[model samples]
Target: MALLQIISAMAMAIAAPLFLGQPLFTLPVAAQAQWSRVHEIPGFGLGTWRSNGDQAAHAVEYALSLGYDHIDAAHIYRNEDETGKGIADANVDRRYIWVTSKLWNTDHQPDRVEPAIRQSLSDLGLDYLDLYLMHWPVAFVPGDGTELDRETSIVDTWRAMEDLVRANLTRFIGISNFSRRNLNVILDICDICPYAHEFELHPYLQQNDFVNFHKEVGIKVIAYSPLGNTNPIYNGRHGNLPPLLEDPFWKKLADVKGASVAQTVLAWGMRRGTVVIPKSVHENHIYQNMFSLEINFNVLEMYNISQQDKRARMNNPSESWGVELFADLDDHTSLDGNKGQEL
Candidate 1:
């Protein structure tokens, strides 16, 4: 780093923590911008999956003031208003922020797409979103049932999303929970090809072939739920099973690097060429996650993590949603996607 840039970065790093009540760190330009505009993104983002109301707003404020330029949210989360307040609370210009919100499945109807963006913009208190994504590949029939709307094709939804961009409701558009086949379908029919694809990706459930396909198609990969769940131990939501967070490999590596497990996991996510958004409401976790970029890994270390991929997915919605969205996950063959591919 140049003497002036190094000194400037140091000043900002020190000041960020002091003002935000959390430690903030910076990575080199090349490392910071794995994709997208260099210096415009922080690579690590805050995922407000279940965060809500004023508390969720506070998290966003802290995250923004702590030097996180990216914030990933969704319409279904029903907290865009709070997320927006947090952005406002941070006291930063919108141009410096990259706010992403997803379109809910119910709003995938051609007529509802524009309204979804409009409502999100109002809820976020923004005139334009940095990026808007289709939350799922399938459209729901809406109600207490998991009935899939057989008629609303993703192609129709993509066209409406394209309209959103043209109308200046969002700066860019993308898709989430999309398989390789889903991407191919969009590529074949899109006038505005998707800019990114968000998915469940971690060491245990690494979708190598899927990610590679995204790279080949020149679309960015955004990883959600980067940290595999350890609910059995913490929340008693399931049986007492081993959690990936407690894996010996990651723990040992983290110890060697003098970092937390979450930090190392995030660093590995970046190494794989995907920007990771791990959600946390606690102060220490937020700091550690942002600072994870400081933990440097060599080629061998990265390869070792890559080799640990068991193709074990953590977020399978097939049962709850009553749709076979990603059966590749169940069979540990995401490389091939679902048989006859579920929409």
Candidate 2:
């Protein structure tokens, strides 16, 4: 039955590859081109950090329908097969979509980098990744939860990644969850600049300094958790700040635009020119997020929403190995300190 299903799917793809290329099996429409240009992203794309393949597939289908041309996955997500299935199900041109994946903290050592990326590629069922990132700056000796000695160095891991790019395992290489200190370390010794950087961001946690610094350095910024995540552990960090989607101001604006609060939040990211990947399992939410590309806020409305910053951050190093490294993190040059400041 599975083989039969696969054959049928392939038949569909061959029959109408361009016009009906989506996991949702929706017909192509004139609106597709507009959606593509409005929603297309160059760096980070679909993120499946906490979902299984079934859920990831649905999200990918929704993304393709909404005109997304990129998909981001990682070994830590444990859903690369599902992500791959979604790509196959979409029936889209493989060359048209940018696929990104990352090596986990446990695989950051120079020796583990190649094997880790090979395993990721195998799980993703892809020949090569469009971009590959070192999931974190710190390295962990396999099976241990602690970082290696300070002298171990990400520079060695980066060297391996540069070789992977040269060997065509991936086309681009970058980092995530890296602080300015860590980034500077890599920049000082590495030969190639990172094509992108991924970090948690939201209206309250604007991350303006890091964003500006990376832009100045020619590194694209990819915003994760743009919704001020409602995860309990994350909420605990901010003393359980109110959800941004439930705010009265956002609700009013949603009503005015006839869109969901989530959609409005995504539109803010799009308008700001940041590549955002807001995760959701619900079919409706996925479609809603994809359609957010069509929603536009007025200039005054954008400014007013930007003023809503309260310095509320959802992700922090409170429980991570580097918690101590960020203990005195009050400079506020990043999102946690600078609230209500203009970009």
Q: Estimate each model's TM-score.
A: 0.84, 0.79
Q: For this target, which candidate reaches the highest TM-score against the unseen true structure?
A: 1
How high is the lDDT of residue 215 in model 2?
72
Task: For residue 56, give model 2's deviation from the true position in Å.
Answer: 2.5
Q: List residue ranges in candidate 1 displaced over 4 A.
A: 1-41, 142-145, 231-241, 328-341
Off by over 4 Å in 2: 1-44, 144-151, 231-235, 322-343
Error of 1 at 177 (Å): 0.5
| Candidate 1 C-alpha lDDT tens digits along 162-261 | 9987776776799998767677889999998888889888777788888888889888899988887642222432224357678899899999989888
Tell me model 1's lDDT, rounded to 2 decimals: 0.76
As a whole number from 0 to 100, the lDDT of residue 114 in candidate 1 is 95
